[model samples]
Target chain A: MNLSRTKIGAILAAPTVVYMVIFFVVPSLILFSYSFWSSESYRVVPDFVFTNYLDSLHSAVFWKVTINAVRIGLTTAAISLVLAVPVGYYLVYVSRSQTMLYLILITWFSSYLVRIYAWRTLLGTNGVLNAVLLQLGIVDHPVDAFLFSSFAVTITLVHIYLPFCILLVTSSLSEIKPDLIDAARDLGTSSLGAFFRVIAPNAANGLAGAFMLTFILVAGDYVTPQMLGGSSGQTTGLLIADQFRKTGNWPLGAAQAFVMFVISIALYFILVSLGRATGLIVKRRTINPKGI
Target chain B: MLLRILVWAVLAFLISPLIVIVLFSFHSSPALSFPFAGFSLRWYAELFNNAQLGSAVMKSLTVAFLTSVVTLLIGTTASLAWLRLGKVGRGFIEAVSVTPIALPGLFVGVSLLVLFAQAGLQLSTLTIVISHVVIALPILIVAMKARLALFDPSLEEASRDLGASQFQTFRRVTLPLIAPTLISSAILAFAVSFDEFVVTSFVAGTETTLPMYIWSMMRRTVTPLINAISTLALLFSILILLGAWLISHVRRRSAVAARIES
Candidate 1:
């Protein structure tokens, strides 16, 4: 650890690079190869074919699922970010509830499977929420209005990912200096105006970073849909997972994965660019936008 | 205001569903139905007796332990690499590690299955662990790297300057400096492997870990026992996370103390 960049670099890089190459990169390399290959009897044949890729690109089923996946990914990020901002502001700026927020975040460290099960119990037809609602006369006896829908899937995802959202946003909020907000308030800005103008603008990069993080997480997820999405709640993840599992089409799976991977990489590049394209905000007193 | 009520309500919504699962597991009722007529710990008691469930939990623990150890080893080394490398190489490693996060894990599962199938490695615990290692490696690297970044490089230098060998300095100085992160990383890897259903589903679909067992059972029929199992697993993770957080807070305070003393 005391060593310079070169010595430390070689020692550290060798094992992980080799490991990633053999384990991480090779498997995916085979997957990429399978993407270009044909399938015979559910096994990847040697023949290089573009049919799976073609079908994936042209098919309505694939497109619909892809769109749904993208929509869910983007929506979950937006909602989680919205919910996250105020909660993050409260945690980082207002509340004396560090331990409580820490407990909430700590719970997330558990297996998502366990967390999914918890949601399953709550969201299932004969589950706790429905039963309580019926007893409270919130609706007629146990209406199946909500569970196992795309809405339910999105809700579950946002809830699960909200912790990460809050953490990232809170950290971002913490990075903003207190004096900027005070300065804005002293210049005749209301509390709300000052918050939106001073704190929010300063935390834009962090918020963008948080949104990208959540969006990427929601995009690549296969679990929320598989467990909660039911038949109608199909997302790209569920489709690709099935291609590997029930369909036994490694080529199709790989092709589908490759498409999703490309989209994610595209988004990731967008994230990187957004980080560098920091010229949007006019960083001067007259352009503070608080008075305006 | 309405906002405070709403935020707290949302928080309750966020936290209660999970806590409710623990409560639901104690239902005297045979199935997973709510509006319990009475309270009973039969499922918890039955969980012990349920041979398959018990075995699945055992299997999950075993897999998790192995995955944690392996992920920690690889992650620590990777962090060492990142810290040592110049800026460009470090950036490259950061981008590379993000693959586990950016790509769907199902793809990782399929890729690993294909690799093992090609290599004639039997679809068993080995393939499962390797996949778990891949899935959990990025997390370990991120967490460990963050901790490693905080550690003072001069501590190792000081030890080495006192005639300690590089290996000895690492063992005494660098290792202790990063011990908390390593433990936290191991716990995180354990949680990832334990809760991992996707890759485990692909590679060890037939081989039942706790999550796989719950998945199959849910598909077949939801049961109170499943809730009990989930709650148990969640509680275990919550405890580990608490430890990780406690260590982090301790580190922050200790860093302040070190700065003050210096």
Candidate 2:
């Protein structure tokens, strides 16, 4: 009738743990190993070599697209976060209603491709934005540049990801009590000053997380760029996707993917350290010198 | 005041694209621009008649259904296990579970593609379902963990003390209590799987889900038909999400009322 916690835990956890191990962990390891393998004429040969990595690193297209991806990703994440902070601030500190939060969540769940199509419709030469511009006599002709440029890709990425960033920012901000801000204000700090001094430091990690998660997702997104990015907006994600989907080079694709993955991780650390350098993220060790 | 305006502006920005899509789906003209020529259901009619789209819809529903069922079982058990485990065990499961979603979909998709290719599994709707389970399971586990954290353990103990078997204790005591959360989480899982694209695109091989269908249509041509189908897909996901939200909201209210009565 009685069971130990360990026994019960094992019984319950076995299924999911086993499932993740097979589907998630094993696949990741296999994919990581595949980066070292070679692919010839659509067949992945299992000889271990660094050519896949070496080739991707040396290739100009790889570097070009990776740089482009990083630019788009950084721009989108920065804009999304900048816009999200005010909304998240309003929701967490200013407003008590859950309605606005739910609305944002709804937008987050709205189909991804649908939004891309919406942007395409809005930004296309003869699309809505041009229509309005033309109707208002804002321009002589529909701008061809709006639809198939890095600008279009970045704008759509911001729209698609802004709600998500807001959610993350809001949750992060929720952990810091409003009373902290109130305390700061009572001590002669201005509202904006309190936000930067009191709020930003405490919420820096969450904000950084929100930023990097958006950066990673936006950077890794292939579909939006393919649909709206045109030739100039090509990203490493699209390149990597093609290696598997079109090029039939699994090892090459896997290598490119790992490269992108490493870049995202590196960016995360860089941003965190940047935050520390700026005093936005205080070190826990410094805060608790005796190791608590 | 400025902050409120900014919040509303962001919300409006968030909602505008969807609004535009829904509105343009009803446009009589082929133009995707602002001048709404007239209203018509012709695109919806076209949506209904497209055999390929209909098949993709069916496939999507089937995959989503299978995904939710699998995710529910795995997630519920994992959540229960999480509640009972020591810190180290819980931490391990939590990390393993949450990592898939924390990473980008492209990574998950490529890794799974490689996994399937290496394992000699044919890419099919089944593969799509497996991948969906991986992505959806994390969401369900996180939601269920939150709900289960609020669960009182003594209730289960009391059921066991009354000569109920462990299974009976779960069925008679735990299941009913957590049924609202379970239903909502399952619906959420279904919504997630249904909207999944990037991962599905990799493992789908030749098979097309609705999003993939939409993608192909977008690539082939620009049409109001795309609008109609997208509107339908968006509406379907929104309705499911609302249902999940409403269920949880109602449960919270009823729980509050029960507390007041007690």
Candidate 3:
């Protein structure tokens, strides 16, 4: 039978909205509420108290780990951009084969566990890197710094998240018309000049978006640091995870998570404002390709 | 020239992990050290014979399949509804839906666990399935919405003008048009579900998925068996991804052909 357009749309959309509300929105809210509640003897007591927040705020370890997380996050973001921008530029402007681009990206779908495990194997005392280094006589002994350190954590995360940056930057680059570069060239601008003046500005949003996404993902990651970050690799994520899983201190964990969430949201807004102030956001508004 | 070398070097770094994993999976030694003592397939055989791992693999597949089907149904309807709304409403809803994806997986897991405990619901495979759907739904919805953005509204309007019911138009015209995107989105949903580890770790309660199994194995000790399992898992992911690419490629070709004919 016939139905009005609004009725049909509602019928189609109701399930998704309802599902998300129940599963995502409500749980997150509960988690937030739990941050204010206190725990007793390893059980969440559900009593309102600010002790967990106070404890987290007062703890030197908390700030130190949080700072460590932020440092790793920024490093991963910078390295990923450096590596991905060139490849994205090459694929969009220089490369002849779109198939090659897809093939490279397709490999990203491989298991995340395998990616970390590969690095672990390579970085371990007798792992491939050490074996090769010793054989080459580059080092007198196996490098203890390679595995179970902050360095390993950063390296593995960069490898894991780089593909996403490439994909985003490539799409942004693709939005630029070939003639825009040609126009700049006709004006007697060098190719590098055209890139700096036209290409980079237009792709700024994508670059910024990539950085933020990678930063959040890397900072919030528990497994990578726990696996690769030996003692030196401990970050805020691992600390929060310990509260929930090992200590059963749900209230404390909830508090720590909210702290992280608040800090990240604040940082994100700062970046957005800075981006707008710098005129980088203007290029995004001008080129609305609308294609995913 | 320098730029090309840098790009290729990054590409090599990206693929090196997989190459190392696959190569060592066949090493005869129990130690994960290099310089293979010769090659053997014993780890693969061991992987198959391990009952717990086999069960976990099946559980992961079952959950992934269920997640994809559920997400496809819910996300398609939601995204379509989303397109009908005004810009503000769409933006608000999209933001709310992506919350699970944006939040840390550990946070999502713990939050859901607390919610379930409060609701007096036991942690079961069903709980696992529900949590998977929460995360998987966003990917499908985003993919479907992107595909839907390119859809022509006049086709639906014309079908309606020709006296077809809304359901009839959707079934005959809209469904066929979006089937390729739906398939690819399902593949994406499946892949996300299959490899999901962190959230599953928090709520899995006695039930083990493949990643959970791998984590336990790694925590206890590293073995060639783990390597074999990882290699298999990597191959499975690559196969699914390739399937998705091929489907989308074929659809692109046919769309091009249709344009020429028109």
What is the lDDT of every predicted structure here? 0.78, 0.89, 0.83
Residue-wise C-alpha lDDT for candidate 3, range B1-262, written one tens digit per residue: 7767887888888888788888899998887775678899989988878899989999999999999999888877776676566675567668868766556788789888888878989888898999999998887776776677888878878998999987798898777777788788888889989999989988888899999999898888767787899889888887888888788779878977997999
Q: What is the per-residue lDDT of model 2 for residues A1-292, given as tens digits with 9 covering 90 to 100?
A: 5689678988899999999999999999999999999888888889899999999999999999999999999999999999999998888888767788778878888899899999999999988889989999999999999988999999999999898899889889999888889998999999899999889988888899999989998999989999999999999998888888856788988999999999999998898888888777875423456643
For candidate 1, what is the DockQ-based docking class? medium
Each candidate's DockQ = 0.58, 0.82, 0.62
Q: Write the per-residue lDDT of candidate 1 for residues A1-292, one digit (tens) a residue.
A: 4666487677678777777778888888888888988888876687688898898999898888888888899899999989888878777767749775866576566557667777776766777778888888897877675677888889888878888788888878998778878888899999789887788767877787788878877877878888788777778887787887755787887899889878877876776576557643333334536646
How many angstroms is the interface RMSD of candidate 2? 1.0
* Candidate 3 iRMSD, 1 decimal: 1.8
lDDT of each residue in B89-175, candidate 2, tens digit only: 988888888888678799999899988987899999889999999999988887887778798888888897899988898888777
Which 10 successive residues of model 2 chain A have the least lDDT summed? A283-292
**Candidate 2 positional error at A257, Å:** 0.7
Ranking 2 against 3 by lDDT, winner: 2
TM-score of chain B of 3: 0.94
For model 2, chain A alone compared with the true chain A gives a TM-score of: 0.95
How far does residue B179 in candidate 2 sit from its true spot (Å)? 2.1
Second chain TM-score per prediction? 0.89, 0.94, 0.94
Please state every model's RMSD to the true fold in angstroms: 3.8, 2.3, 3.4
Clashes of each: 1, 0, 0
